[model samples]
Target: HREAHAMQKDWMRQSGIEEEEKAPSIDNFEKIAAERVHLGLLVNELVLSRELKLDDEKVKTKLAEVTNAYPNGDEIRKMYEQNSELMDQLKSTVMEDQVVEWLTERSSFNEKEIEFKELINNNQ
Candidate 1:
């Protein structure tokens, strides 16, 4: 990866691409932070409005769905079961997905195709 990265950098230099490609400005950082906070607030509001609750069954199901994707599914499941922090994180993730699913079901979206780099580097 190191050699590939160096080659990529050389190609970028030769192509006259600026070195600040990955360097985001302060405004971008602020915008990203603000968007995160806004999303958090929206999720919280949705949870409270709908009285959504995360039950143990839901967490277990989500954990199973995730661990089953790995080769050592039982090992990963055991680790998540034993670790309170990991379980909590998983619970949060489950709740986030629940919120997103609710919004997606209730909302309309306009789909368009674009380059992957444009989507990821949009904030910059």
Candidate 2:
């Protein structure tokens, strides 16, 4: 990041664009923040449209996968012991996913399949 900033400074010097001492007073900060929130909501909507779920079985499977990485790893057990609240939150997340999946099956959404490369390029 420092290197990028230094390069930017050099570029500014060459181009004769002075760096401002302070940020501009953008009157529409609230509007910009709202747009970012809306974009996040839209991205979640896209994921929900795919009928994804994170149910109890899914959570267990994920935990098992992680534990498999270290044969004698007690990280999962330690996490469960230390983070009871996190466990409950994970349970709620799983329940919410199940509900969303149920709703998605009944809801109407446009279906379009695009290549992963094309999707990445489009996002960029």
Candidate 3:
């Protein structure tokens, strides 16, 4: 932050905007944080309400499938170490998908395959 401020000061001096007053504060940091927490809780509840279960065996199998993409064992281990928390998050996501799959498996949910180009065009 100190370096960023220093660089900003230099830029301001160069641009002859040093005398300009600081921008007004929105002062909604807490509100934004609360909203983010609320969104996270909402998503988690959605996953949980679906009764998603992620067993250790499933996690291992998924990991094995993922590791297949990384030919180097050390690279895979390094990636896992660097993103252990992300791994847990992915596991949770897998559990949620399992719930979705389970529901769709029991009850038929009519799904149609659209061409990739058509789907993108429609989204845009």
- For each candidate, give its TM-score against the true structure: 0.55, 0.35, 0.44
Pairs in clash, predicted candidate 2:
none
1-124 in candidate 2: lDDT tens per residue?
3434444555566777685343232332445556645754764675578655556677675556655678665876567547878676455555555666666789997899999999999999
Which clashing pairs does model 3 show?
A: none
TM-score winner, 1 or 2: 1
Query: Candidate 2 local accuracy as lDDT?
Result: 0.60
The sequence of per-residue lDDT tens digits that candidate 3 reaches over residues 7-86 is: 45655677777553552222323455566567657657856786655777777677767777777965785676589786
Off by over 4 Å in 3: 1-43, 81-83, 109-124
Specify the poorest-scoring 10-residue window by lDDT in model 1. Answer: 23-32
C-alpha-based local distance difference test score of model 3: 0.64
lDDT of all the models against the reference? Answer: 0.78, 0.60, 0.64
Instruction: Give per-candidate clash totals.
Output: 0, 0, 0
Q: Which ten residues in a row are the worst by lDDT in model 3?
A: 20-29
Tell me how far the alpha carbon of residue 22 in candidate 3 is from the true structure, in angstroms, after superposition: 23
The top-ranked prediction according to TM-score is 1
Task: Report the candidate with higher TM-score, 1 versus 3.
Answer: 1
Q: How accurate is candidate 1 locally (lDDT)?
A: 0.78
What's the candidate order when arranged by decreasing lDDT? 1, 3, 2
As for lDDT, the candidate ahead, 1 or 3, is: 1
